[model samples]
Target chain A: MVKLRARCLLLGDAAVGKSALCHMFHSDGTLFQKNYSMTTGVGLLMKCVNVPETNDSVELYIIDSAGKETLVEACEKMWGQPSLLCLVFDLTSEQSFASCSHWMERVHAHCEGLHVPGVLVGNKSDLSARREVQGSVAQEWAESQGLEYHETSAKEMENCDAPLLGLARAFHSLYQERRETIQNLSPG
Target chain B: MIDSSLTSLGAKVVVATSSDENHPPENIIDGNTTTFWMSTGMFPQEFIICFAEPTMISAVTVDSFNVKHLKIEKNTSQNASNFAFVGEKELEHTDGHIQTNAVSLNGSSATHLRFIITSGYDHFVSVHRVSVQN
Candidate 1:
């Protein structure tokens, strides 16, 4: 069986359910924090995702950073060359959703111009009554950024695994593509 | 052009009998001779490399330190079991330098390759890299 490891960076504005989504997925949906605690530094959580229909697995090191503007600079230094990204946004907040490009630019700078495969996560889907970001708009923006879009509700543990699972599958496909290039090499 | 073409194109070491946090098993296929995976200290150490798919492998070259004997086996199944013997090599120890040896696999097709280290020149052995020719 093949096992791989990848660094997945979680990005978003504060109170966008970044930590909640991370913790919910890490705990396998058993725990969701009812009380809020501000994250000052980077919080790391790891979970192994078994790719469906394959013996392969990917161990994702999810780097959950503090989203406050004052804390973002300090958090930026801790995100080192992430191979995958989980860009989160609050579904009820247009400002948070608009800030996605800024967060992605920071990631682009930190990655030294390498294209990182990732997902744009619209969190807080359970709060449909307060939603401000339209699904079509989010999907269009995600397509423009070369990212797959996923809507999730960390509070209700709805579709929490889909984003990470998609990342694992994407990484697996990258390895497969690399192998195909080698297979094309004629024996010397 | 076929010199270590396997890892240069992209194949990864998925399993190792010994892995250091700093020197992971993945480093063995990273195409760097300076970085290596060291055994914790024992005989009968092994590691499995899984390819993207079943590949036609003709040969492989191993770069290492303190290794005495090496055995290779391959399997075409998706699972890493039921491997057949491909070949074996008795490596000569190089003092402080790396030992580079190449073994032919008789053009076998496999999805997984298993390398078994039955004995070593020292308690701890480090495999620097493995390059395959198909």
Candidate 2:
């Protein structure tokens, strides 16, 4: 069994369900209103995901960084990880969607030229009538920035896992291509 | 100005708030010789408190709002207050309004009992009276 290591960062505005989304994916249940700091520092967790197609497993280091300004030091730590970065925005809050550009800019500034795969996720899609950002709008914005986008409702578990799975597939394909190129260039 | 009718001691109190960078007056804590008064508007979980006494017990007198609980902490030496769990008994619940159980400091009076708002509604703990009987 192939054991791969990956990391994922969840970044967004405060109270955009980043923590809730993480809990849903990790624990597969709804947690009650518990102690929530404004994400003071980075909240870290680790999970192992079994790839159904390859029958391999990958251990993911999940980093949920603080959205509050007081925790800039914590958010700075995520800059060096070459894992997949996910930008979560609240569909019902237009301000959150508009703030996506700022978040993306921060990632770009920190990651620099690293090939960090990203996903633009518009959460709270279940509340369509109250949506501040339409699906097409987010998709267009993500496409323009060379990032993949998906609308998911963590509350409803809608399209919640697709973005991560898609990124894993892309990462695996890229790894394979790199290995093939190196093999062909070997003198032996 | 000190109110001698209740109790008298000197210490510090910490009040936490969740206001954004552009927002001011997040919370207020004015310390007196014997007690500290506070007004907070953030959610209950967002507030925190720390005390200045060593091996000392601290009690929070919550008024004007209903709290699920108030987290308490003690110190052997001066350091950050660790999370301590405390339960509440209904002091008064009438006409859709509620109050908290009065916390007591076991007859042993001290200079400091930090009032941190760990979680609950938005209100002020006016502290109408306090006495260090011990």
- Sum up the clashes in candidate 1: 0
Candidate 2 chain A least-lDDT 10 residues: A179-188
lDDT of every predicted structure (CA atoms): 0.83, 0.54
Off by over 4 Å in 2: A29-37, A186-188, B1-134
Across residues B44-118, which tens digit of lDDT does each residue of candidate 1 receive? Answer: 789999998888889988988767899999999988899999999999967646788999999989899999999
- Candidate 2 structure quality by residue, lDDT tens digits, A142-176: 88876789888777877777666655655555444
TM-score (all chains, Cα) for each model: 0.62, 0.53
Tens digits of per-residue lDDT, candidate 1, A43-159, equal: 999889998898878778899999999999999998976778899999999999999999999899976555678999999999999999999999999999989999999889899
C-alpha RMSD by candidate, in order: 13.6, 21.5
Candidate 2 residue lDDT tens string, B15-98: 434322221122122322122223222223333333334424334444323343454433333544543434333344222232
